[model samples]
Target: MKPIVTLTINPTIDLATAVAEVTPEHKLRCDAERRDPGGGGLNVARVIRELGGESLALYPRGGSTGELLERLLEEKRLRRWPISISGHTRENFTVTERKSGREFRFVMPGPTLTEAEWKTVLDSLSTVAADVEFIVASGSLAPGVPVDFYARVAHIAREQNAKLVLDTSGEPLRAALEEGVFFAKPNRKEFRDMMGPQVDEPAGMAAAARSFLEKGRAEILVVSMGADGAMLTTREGQYRAVPPPVKTASSVGAGDSFVGGMTFGLARGLPPHEAFRWGIASGTAALMSQGTDLCSRQDVEHLLTQVQPTRLA
Candidate 1:
């Protein structure tokens, strides 16, 4: 089987803790904290590994946190292509209030990349893109990285004859779309923001997606709508996947898991709708776990059986 390669321009160490409550001006006690290797692409890579799939995580690392991130990845026995940088990698904090079940996240902007650093990353991607069948570029671009970074990666993927699956938002996504990509997975807010005020309803959303398809910007569009389910459109048809109802632990990383599952299905040669089922399953599974634990292989398989796909006109 061809290898799966994920490119994460910005990665971090995710620290999660449970607190009774978060009240301003009041000191709060918290439970033990858990730390894990994180970032959008890293989450996807971790999910892929949990599913017994092989993936190479390509990202930059620096400072002491970067060392911890490397150690964590080593503990997972996952392969990595580390691009050493001068700046330290950032850290993200997730605080879950056990009583209210509310989760608050504090994300830090990652290390800034220099012109030389960016060129090195691009060169490395040029090499790795050749050996992989799929290149999953998911996450925010750090400062100093051009907005068209993903677009360049998309171009490289095309040159290597590999599929590029993009999971990002805002200008980066819009910029990449201008350059054209194979697939894109954006949540409701990101989609709305990209579509602007013109798209306010479901039909409008569909139309905006169709516009992208018509322009050949993306072959498949997956818009995840949180608890309302997800909308998937392809050249062949469109469908909405409604997952079984369950209590959501933490919404963080769910979207990344969805991308991971969708990529997993595509890698296995599944049809679009079938692949979407896995994507929804993976997302719902991630919701069942607290903090940054993400989705497990067992949860994903079990939830896959409960995912129902409805065709859209």
Candidate 2:
């Protein structure tokens, strides 16, 4: 097994297409479609591979869509271990309006997981936890799973001395935070959802992150502000990064790319600030592609030169 591992309880096959205009009650014909294996941990693994790193993607799969998802992952050559479930995996659709440059996303809640199935996931992680350097568990919880699922994963990470990097929201996020994590990233929208609308400003966001850091809820609290940029707060100090200007085709997979790049840098023994710079570059690089295409190594390398991270403290 590779030293880096990612866990995704809910996975999906992302289907994307473009249409000229969206009108109510109109049968709008879309252009050719593209499908990709998606979900938080899977996307992160893909980005790590694009950056010349390897990770084992552990997720649950079921039915026809699940088979298609595996085939897509195979196409990307992602090292994966997919657990079989009774219900079919979900599919997410994205439609881009060419005229208005607007994107519409429709998501489905994934299949339910039985207690035995969820325990199997934990068992799988337990077997590999000590051997891995990081356990990245992201995405939303499916039905039939407890809210403390990630917190349970966090405990395994702590027990194995592996860093837990989380990218989730709501009660699952809060539960994991109570267990403490090495790194936790919540996009601006998710941050707002968790901390309320009052914490939307930069300073407010920073203060919120600082509170978590001071409370030992997380060693590093990163609030990812789409387009605006990202801020990182730690006990040592705080830093902010502004991504270089790039025309965006879609914001899909950008945050996952950030997690992948930052984890890749940290796994290579780089410090948090430098790792965060890599994250910004990766996220910017992701914007350089259309649809679900993640960041390429070349684009990331080039963008890394343009990333300027500032010490806020």
Candidate 3:
């Protein structure tokens, strides 16, 4: 088995285009379109492949859109295992306004999954995760899937002796934490919402995350603050990786890139603090690219020099 395996239950075909401007009630002509296979775990697997790491991406596929998604990932030469589903995979659209450089995104709730289909995903994980070091479950649950899906994944990872790295939000995240994961990355807002109103600042974030660690909810937690940077909290201590300022072309896929880089670094035997810096550099590098373009290996290497990680507590 590969060292890392990623799972995306709700995947999408991302269609992106650029327009001169966006105005209500006007027909806006768009530039040439670009399509990418997108979803949290898929993006993570893509970024890992871009960084010269190997990982297997596991996700559902159906209909013509799903077929195209598979083709797109194939073009990128990403290793994947597609679970067959009865529902057509969803398509998400993004239009970047060239004049204002603003992006407008239309995201569809993904296709519903049958009970048998989701159970199939779990069953597959039992086999695929048996020898993998890390099982990265990222993205949302599709309609008709339980909110405890990732929690179930965590249980499988535990039974298989694999570390579960989760990147998601809302009740699914909360439930998964109850089941416990090895690591979790939640954006600042999501972290705040999950931790409640009392965790209004970074100071409180460390304390709350440590509490989770002490309770065995997670071994490590990361709160990403976009341009501000990200904080890593573990039972041992807290560290923050801050990036040098750079102009951001697009924010799409940055978070997934971060998770990919960090997880890849860990798989490569980097210490937690150093892996946190890799995540910061990779995420910042992703911001330097235009729509749907993730960070390249060269860009990540260059930005690695610009990331400075400091012990917070």
Best by TM-score: 3
TM-score of each: 0.97, 0.97, 0.98
- Winner by lDDT: 3
- Report the lDDT of model 3 for residue 173: 95
TM-score of 1: 0.97
Q: Between which residue pairs do clashes occur in model 3?
A: none
Worst 10 residues of 3 by lDDT: 197-206
Superposed by TM-score, candidate 2 places the C-alpha of residue 300 at a distance from the truth, in angstroms, of 0.8
What tens-digit string does per-residue lDDT give for candidate 2 at 1-313?
2558999999999999999999999899999999999889988999888998889999999999999998999999988888888889999999999999898999999899999988998889888887888889989998999999999999999999899999999999999989999999998888888777768667887787787688899898788888878998889899999999988878888999999999898888888999999899998899889987899899999999999889988
lDDT of 1: 0.89
Instruction: Give the per-residue Cα lDDT of candidate 2 at 36.
Output: 94
Q: List all candidate RMSDs to the true structure.
A: 1.2, 1.4, 1.1
Better of 1 and 3 by lDDT: 3
Provide the lDDT at 55 for model 1. 89
Q: Which candidate would rank higher by lDDT, 2 or 3?
A: 3
Best to worst by lDDT, what's the order?
A: 3, 2, 1
**How does residue 43 of candidate 3 score in lDDT?**
93
